[model samples]
Target: MSTLVVRRAPITRVLRSELRMVLRRPRTLIGLGLLALVPVLMGIGIAIATANGEEGGAEGLAALVIGNGMLLPIFALSIAMAMLLPLTGAMLAADALAGESAHGTLRGMLMAPVGRGRLLAVKAFGVASVTLIAVLLMALTGIISGVLLLGGDGMLTASGTSLPFLDALGRVLITALYVTLQVWALAAVALAVSAFTEHPLIVVVVSLGLVIVSGVLAAIPALDWLDPVLVTTSWDAVSEVVRDPIEWGPLVEGGLRALCYLVIGGSIAYSRMLTRDG
Candidate 1:
């Protein structure tokens, strides 16, 4: 009688593998490299333009050049949040399942001991991890660049109040986490679209298209009420958190809105992955 050793793949192991693969890709490296440049370029340009914060726009440019180390990340986030972060999320997630299917490897993934739902959960987590890292890197780069060029001594609140360095750092972190939630939800929707197609390009295009459509519609007066519900409308939720007193309403609603989409998108992807032969 031969006793067989059974090897079970834990979700953590799966997640690790996914992360390793994602990070090793040349495209990922290049994208992150370019993203890291955004803050550096912005910092340099602002420093030169404002004469290193000695000229005009002092009040307006304080966070960016106000010589506040803690506020540097927040300023960087403001630049990227409008488009780069969202596009980064869509690109990172667009290939999760679709690329596998397009290359005929998805069937092999399904054949693994891991369940389809668990596999997708793992993929989503992996992509979210990368997206989160990207956000941090952007902020980190900003902090470094700002300190080198402008300085980071006097942290200021939107209300013109001074903040301790530690307090400002804390708020910057909170904002990064808030941005992470946004990407995580967006990843799920992109993954769902990926499940139905074998083209990763289609997955990315459609995911972004949905955002553009919702954003445009939300801007219209006739659809003002829908702003609260549109997937793209909560991008500014973090702005509320950095202020003094810290209003939590928009933050909570933004998180829940993302959670709702995560459920719907993950469910759709799971069901489709299970039923589809290829």
Candidate 2:
């Protein structure tokens, strides 16, 4: 008898292939393009309002961005996080497992020589990358459009103080990372859902429904008791970065909450993958 050897694929190569498959998808490209446009549209809207002497009506971060161009990325992220950002994450998660299953590729992947747990990890990484890219694209476009339309006026803190360019950029990066964590939590939930379904549309619908329901529940004063468990409850904490001293309390709490979701979601996904029948 002759002994034969089989080599496992390198993890880096698997991840790179997964990422390429994700980025080359037409829907992924289209979604990213649209996300990049959001900040540009916001910048244009603000510029037109300023030209028309309507800046007085602006409020919240939008008002702040008028005077602080560097704040535009933060402002756009604040708006996008509520819907578009999470939706993009949800879409990526849907495509990770459910889409592949629907196309009959998931069964093939499950039957491959790679361990199922490692396969789940690769899918999760691909989804996570999509969310990160979507956020960075929006931020980059926001920064460019803000500079062109509003000028780089540094950044204004909630305390009515000004921050230098580098300091403000650091804050913007922190804010982006914070928002990305929250969206990643959402994507994890979607990925778990994806493992349970063969229909990608079902994953998207269920994930989005969870988001809307969480938002609604968070809005109810009576549901204050549920604040600690609700996912969207701490989403607004991203604004804490805009303060002069950078409030760490809410941000830390929000990040911890997201971590909990990430753990639970990943656990469920892995369990399902292990028990799944090919």
Candidate 3:
């Protein structure tokens, strides 16, 4: 018998193929379109605030900061995680094994000179890249809209203090980074769920259900102690980035918790993908 040679594919080639697949899907395109509209929505919100006598300066900045600072970022982060992020992650990962199996291509692909582990790794990396891109796009749209509509003057902080325009911009950027990390944690959960199911809708529903349940659990007064334990609790950590005195405790703890979720979720996904029958 001839020896079977396993040739590793370039990561770039795999990523390119993944992107093409993602772009071709109408659902993915719809998600991207919605994310693009965030700026317009923010503009409308700002306009309404302005019409209510909130214009640029310390008062304008204060109003903008109070209105959007934590709240806007939280909304952006939640929407990205609850909807767009999961949609892309589930599309890629659910399709990874199930789509091929449905089309009777999995066996053929497996017979090729590629190890199962390598194939899985490529799929995981592709899904992750897509998730990050979606999150970054959302943040970009939100921040630009906020600055333009709210007027990039001084900023009124959560603690009733003011900062220079440049400083406010820096805070907004840092908040965006935190939002991105939170979305990454959500994407990891979707990927893990995707690895277990053959139905793409089921994967999406399950992941979303987890998010909703976490949110609910985090909100209950009796579960006050459990709030810190829930991954969803950390979703608002970006707000702390802009607060005076700059409380790093919540952000730091949140980051650590999010990292733990990513590790656990990724481990589960890898194990399921490797061992499950295609």
Q: Please, what is the whole-model Cα lDDT of each candidate in the order they appear?
A: 0.78, 0.90, 0.66
For each candidate, give its TM-score against the true structure. 0.91, 0.97, 0.80
Which scores higher on TM-score, 2 or 3?
Answer: 2
Could you tell me which 10 consecutive residues in candidate 1 have the lowest summed lDDT?
A: 57-66
Residue 220 displacement in candidate 3 (angstroms): 2.7
Q: What's the CA error at residue 66 for candidate 1, in Å?
A: 4.3
Better of 2 and 3 by lDDT: 2
**Model 3: CA > 4 A from native:** 1-6, 52-63, 66-75, 78-111
Model 2 agreement with the true structure over 47-126: per-residue lDDT tens digits? 88888888676677777887467888999999999999988999999999999999999999998878889999999999
lDDT tens digits, residue span 69-154, model 3: 33344345554554555455556556665565667666676676676667766766666666666666766676666666655456
Candidate 3 lDDT score at position 220: 82
lDDT of 1 by residue, 27-140 (tens): 888888888888888778767766644565455434334555566677778657767877887888776788878889888888776677787777788788899899889878
Best by lDDT: 2
Q: How many pairs of residues in model 2 come into backbone collision? A: 0
